[model samples]
Target: MADDSHLRETPLSRTELLRGHFLHVVRDTVRMPDGAQATREFVLHPGAVMVIGLLDDGRVVMERQFRHPMQAVMIEFPAGKLDAGEGSLACAQRELLEETGYSAREWAFAGRLAPTIAYSDEVIDIWFARGLTLGERRLDEGEFLDVFAATPAELQAWCFSGEVIDCKTLIGSMWLQNVQRGEWVLPWAASPGGADAGESGT
Candidate 1:
C-alpha cells in the first residue's frame, strides 16, 4: 500500500502569539482538506522527564502532592520539566532525588509519552531506577511533596480505585510491571537487579 498518496497537507497561517517561561503560544489558522478552515491555539513547551524508582524488593516509589491546576492532591511518579540544555537521563536522576530524597546506582530509559498533544507540545521521558540509596532532597523553593513506596499489587489497586489519578504515573507503573515480568527490557541492564536489591539513603 502506498500510504503516502493519501496524505494531504493542512495549510496554516499564524494569527496570534506569545512567548514566555519555557512556553511559546501561537494561534494558527488551518485550512482543512475539505476546504474548511479553523483557528487553533497551541502551546509549545520543553519536554520533561519522569522516573519509576523500584526497590530491590520490587516496590515502586511514588509521591503525593497538590496540583494547583487540578486543585487536588494526587499521587504521581517523580518528574520535572527538563532544564535548558539538560540531558534526559540527568534530568531523571535529578528529579528522582529531589522529589524522593533517593538515588539509584542503576538507571534505565523506559519510554516516552506525550500527555497532551492536541494543545500542548511536550514529551515526557520515562526511566527506571534501581540499586537505590537515600540522599539530600534539593527541592525547588516552592515545591512540597510526600513520598511513599508501594508493591505492584498496591500500585494497581491505587490506579484502578482512583487513588492515583496522574496519567504519567499510571503509565510508568504499567511499564515497570511489564519490564519486571520480562515482557520489556531496559535499554541498559548489564547485570539487572541482584542480591543487593533494596533501599538505601545517601
Candidate 2:
C-alpha cells in the first residue's frame, strides 16, 4: 500500500476579490501536473454545516423549504452556512435546533462535500446527529420550513418521487445510511483495521 503520509496535496497561490453578503471571489494560480501553470477562479466560501438528525426510533429529521434558486419546495436535512469564525459542529447544532426543533446528545463528523466545484470553493461539512430530543424551534426572521421525520425507505421514496431534490440533503442522507450500515467511516476515526481514506458521498 502507498504510504499515506507521502501523498501529494494541491498547492495554490490565491488573490481575493469581491467580499460581500456571504460570498467572496478568489483567483488562484496553480501548477499543472505536466510542469505547466494555470489560473483557476474560485468563489472562496466560509463553508457550511448539515445535520442528519436521527431520532430515537431511527427516523431521520428533515425539513421542507422553498429554495429561491430552484423556485421549488424541497425536502432537505437541516443545514446552514458557517458564520465567520464559527466551528462546523457548532453550526450543525444551531441549525438542527433552529430548523427542526430538535437537539442531539451525540454528534459526529460524517464527512465533507463540495456541492459546486466548477465555480466555487465551497466545502460543506456534514455531521451525524443522534439521540435526538425535541425543543423549541427558532427560525430566522424570514425563514420558513416544515419539518418531518422519515425512515430510510421513506426517504428513498421521497428522493425518487422528487420530494427531496436538494443535492446536499440527498448526499447527507445516503452517507448517514451507509455509516449506519458500517460501510463508511471518517478518516480521523479510522484505525489500523479500518478504512483509512475519506469517503465523499457527493
lDDT for each residue of candidate 2 in 1-202, tens digit (9 for 90 to 100)? 7676433334578888788876788877877666567888878878998888778888889888998878988788889988778777767777777777776666778789999989987899998867667867879888999998889889888778877778898898689778878899743322112121111111
TM-score of 1: 0.85
Please list all clashing residue pairs in model 2, or write none if there are none: none
Worst 10-residue lDDT window for candidate 2 reads: 193-202
**What is candidate 2's TM-score against the reference?**
0.77
| Whole-model Cα lDDT of every candidate shown, in order | 0.79, 0.76
By summed lDDT, which 10 consecutive residues of candidate 1 come out lowest? Answer: 193-202
What stretches of model 1 exceed 4 Å from their correct place? Answer: 1-11, 15-17, 20-23, 189-202
